[model samples]
Target: MAAVIFLVAAAAGGGSAVWFGAQGWGKAANQSPPVLPPATAEVTRQTLTATSEYDGELGYGVATTTTNRLTGTITGLPDVGDVIKRGQSLYSVDGDPVILLYGELPAYRTLKEGDEGPDVEQLERNLEELGYDGFTVDDEFTWRTAAAVEEWQDDLGLAETGTVELGRVAFLPESRRIDGLEVELGAAATPGQPVLSHTSTAKAVTVQLEPSDLADVKTGAEVEVELPDGKRVPAKITELSTEVQAGSGQQEEASTVVIAVAELSGDKAIEAAAGYDQAAVDLIVTTGERKDVLTVPVTALLALAEGGYGLEVVAGGTTSYVKVDTGLFADGRVEVSGAGIDEGTVVGIPE
Candidate 1:
């Protein structure tokens, strides 16, 4: 006669614990005929990818505020969406242009013949880029560099003092599109006052995730962005930053968040996002993948009482347990390999 076998079914990848009590017949001298399993599934081979999706905004990315270091009335302001490049007039103060230069260091002091520092070198680089040459682009600001600056000032109709005065120029890392004007045309332009806000012209997706969610994400990681029109485009993370957000109420606690900026890489993304300036999108990042491997539903795995894990192979009206080794677990399927476990092998599943 058949006898009952108690089995503990634990899903792979730390799934919940399940206990199953069933009747079974084994091929032995005194055992009865075999009993069929209630349910069965076949082992199959396919690629599986583990991914996480987050809400993102598709736009020109973050905006940086351009503060005024000059003192005068705001005579001219660029219209919103105006792109300012190197050697161009970003805005005007008292009818004089505050030139835009490409550099990382801000103009902190007046750069003259005797000043020697990184800011001087930055100015010299911009002067050389604007076609005013003859001076070495170094940390030292010599008379020759002042001569080039005089020439540049002459072109902009400024005083030919041969000394670059503070507040005469604004330094940015690159060309930027005007995002918004902070002050009106007639507003007073005082030192340290914000003038306008700008951003890069390239299309990007911005995602804010919890700090713990950023463990697998890094700069230069490739990801897919799903646009509003159901188009998928490839992108790469270009920047990452962390910020602490203060709580609004006393009962709330402050939280740290990671900001991820991903720039769109190909023409497909540009074309798909042509009509919209900003839209909601989804950022999909793949964390793990496995290709061409035998897999089974996680529920099919049985925790053996002896040790390790096993699967009940159902064949020809009889069932036998085959111990198997497991690998990556993804999408409710576990990568499995062992003796007698091949593609099309029917494995028993709990009803």
Candidate 2:
């Protein structure tokens, strides 16, 4: 009976194996292992430097505005945005003959050195009537001009500055004229006032500094000014007035300061604006820098078995895990300090 039972059990086990083989399970077990896909990686480097960057705008160095001395109608003046030179004739007062007055002027009236018109004779006659000598009514302010100015000042009870103050002559400042027609010919002007505008534009820049950043800046700080044409101009902080000016954003409680910079390299555009341009300005102030550090991509690190972090290194088609220490991060890279990993070592990426 025991022999018969053993034969039956062997026959049952054989039948079961035949059924499973016909189902393809046996053939699948004998198939070759699966091949992994290719992985991308980067080699480690010993020397790595990190940098921070900022973006801003380009602007003019200086800009000047003009106002009128006497309130008059706009007349006999160049149009706006016109370039002018020193001593250019801007406008005339009325059709009336001009009178020149100065506390420092000679008592005898004489034509200026550049005067060559018929008015020169009239000037000489006027000077002689004032009882000044050295001029034969020749219409010129000569050395006798100095004596005449002293006499004039004495008569007016005013101190002489060795220069004439032409207050009465249709009364325009010599060597400079109105830049543009600020008022009309019939406009009335008061004594000792500005009728035309003038600007030097020598060394100027329009700098916009954050009021909150005042702690990092002051007058005389180094600055770099860029022009619209990609020109980089060197400048130094000159004025740091706390006064806020009009800008794109207007906040009653919020505040900002306008900084003025002077070009140290003597830029022509800056000099013209007198160190104050209407264009925008950009400023670069470095906060810090770091260099020569080991770094890696943030994606390469993996959790290790012993509660540490590691990366997988591939060599000879075999993957070996490596443990590493990490440090600072800048941009997309993180600084790492590790052992058994030399520069240019290719690390494997996990599947």
Candidate 3:
């Protein structure tokens, strides 16, 4: 039985099996590194620097709202977006004086009401031109005035409350009236109806910063704004709010901030203002420049068993792991600031 077992084992080639396997493994290990080409890499130098970005908008530096003081239908006036200077006459009210109900009429009221002067006429003309068709220029609030008021209220969707509210007059739409806000036209508003809106006069860029980066922001930091049209506007940081906004996904809670008072040079200012209202703002507050410094491909810098970093430097056909002090890392190259590693040194990547 022992002889028969030996014959079967020999046929199976017991000794040859281990030897062939070892030989194949050795050949594979030897040729692996060279067979697959060493990853070709380039080295560069790092420099210390700062960069800035302005994430704000470009618009008229000042935004303002004009309101309708009297309840009336809109009449003749410049179309929305007409630029006006201070003290420029914009819109006028009609000549029909609105019946101002006073709980107690004063002795002076009779004289003032009857005084039909140019001021009242001018007010009427202005109001008529401004779309206030509720009153005639006869300088008195008559039945026709009431009819016009009701008609105006119907057009503006306001309740037929004839008594004017001064607040309603202050909140008129200067340009295109939006639907979401409280100050809407075509609504029957009384005296004091808020019809106008005002926002930031100047255009600015708004951006949200990650919480980790919030500390880096401050007022008066120099910033650069890049427009989608490839235009860059330089500006100083004007404000930074500490309010943190929650992110929707993948992003952490961040703070949205606005930067104003941008310094746009020449026609670039006009170019920036053209589409800045809806433009995406890229704010850069850090400035960086490329400089010549000792740098190596980041992969070469390995964490050594000891402290510091290590790299395989090939010299005279011999490779040695040399320790290196790394500096700033940029452009895929680590700034190497140590001895033993020089420029153009052929380094071997680990097996």
Candidate 4:
């Protein structure tokens, strides 16, 4: 015998309205008005996913403004979308190339053969990476380091000063794809002036999630990106930023937005979104998923009088009541489990 998760307590003896509370059934004699027929549903197994979709922007990533450090006329600028690599000119100032180097520490001062600091180490590390040899990679710049600098300078057509001064090179964490330009050619470029903005070449989708959605948005969760062409691409949550921005509306209150990054992985995703740039897409976040679970139409649920819930399990001509616990509720079907219920158990529904 299956234990009933009675939503309402069944009476010991037949009484006026036999059913007790929210979801209990009346005594079989009073269950139906002669006109309405009984309806039934099969209890079966299937997979389910609890998810939601939101509008998202598809692109490389957020653009970071690239600022200049040395004052000069902006003689040359890379075309938007140019992929700048090491030894290449990021932008020319007074016709001298501010060579691109891969590093995180920004150059803060004029570096010479005698300087010693983390900046020097960054410069030396880049020099070695650029194929300049004979200089041990270290913070202390030696004579060999100066020689390497001179060779690099000659290659870029600059005076071989054998020293790196602020503004002669730009250090980024890695290669970058120029996303946009902020200044025009021949514009006066001053220290700390905005030059341009860029992002990684890889494709990603960004979402500005509302506060309520944060609970379902987790790093590493799988998501589906619906492209503008109506095609779907698989992606994963790569990053999340909890940022607070002040509102400019009449209320003038601050609001926190969860900024998420969904990276499109695999060759298929790349091929699908290869031609797109700054396009709108749909992001389906799968908060939860379940498979092979017992489920029935939501209508089968009866709020029990005692607090839980009960399923009106119909057997033969009479309805046998059974208590049940609920699980995932999706697509008008809900998960349920209780004693006595089987894959083919029939449950009752209102007419």
Best by lDDT: 1
Q: After superposition, how far is residue 38 of candidate 3 from its true place, in Å?
A: 1.7
Score residue 223 of candidate 1 by CA lDDT.
96
* Residue 17 in model 4: lDDT: 16
Ranking by TM-score: 1, 4, 3, 2
Candidate 2 lands at a TM-score of: 0.38
Q: What is the TM-score of each candidate against the true structure?
A: 0.85, 0.38, 0.46, 0.83
lDDT against the true structure, per candidate, is 0.84, 0.46, 0.46, 0.81
lDDT of 1 by residue, 1-351 (tens): 011143333323232222221223245679777666677899999997888899999988888898888888999999998889999999999999988899999889998999999999999988888889999999999999989988998999999999988889899999999999999989998989999999888899999988788777889999999998888899999889999999999999998999999989898888888887899999999988899999999988877655667787887777766778888788899999987789999988865
User: Model 3: per-residue lDDT, tens digit, 1-351?
Assistant: 222232234336643212322233224554542222144333444464445443454543333344445666433243344433222323323322222111121112211233454433433443465466856776564555455555555554566654334423322222222212234334553444443433433455555554455455666666677777776676555545445466877766764643234434346555655665556667666644446777777776655433466565554443344557777665556777655556676665543
Give candidate 4 regions above 4 Å deviation: 1-39
Task: Please identify which of the two predictions, 1 or 2, would achieve the higher lDDT against the true structure.
Answer: 1
- Report the number of the highest-TM-score candidate: 1
Ranking 2 against 3 by TM-score, winner: 3
Candidates 1 and 4: which is better by lDDT?
A: 1
Candidates 1 and 3 compared: the better one by TM-score is: 1
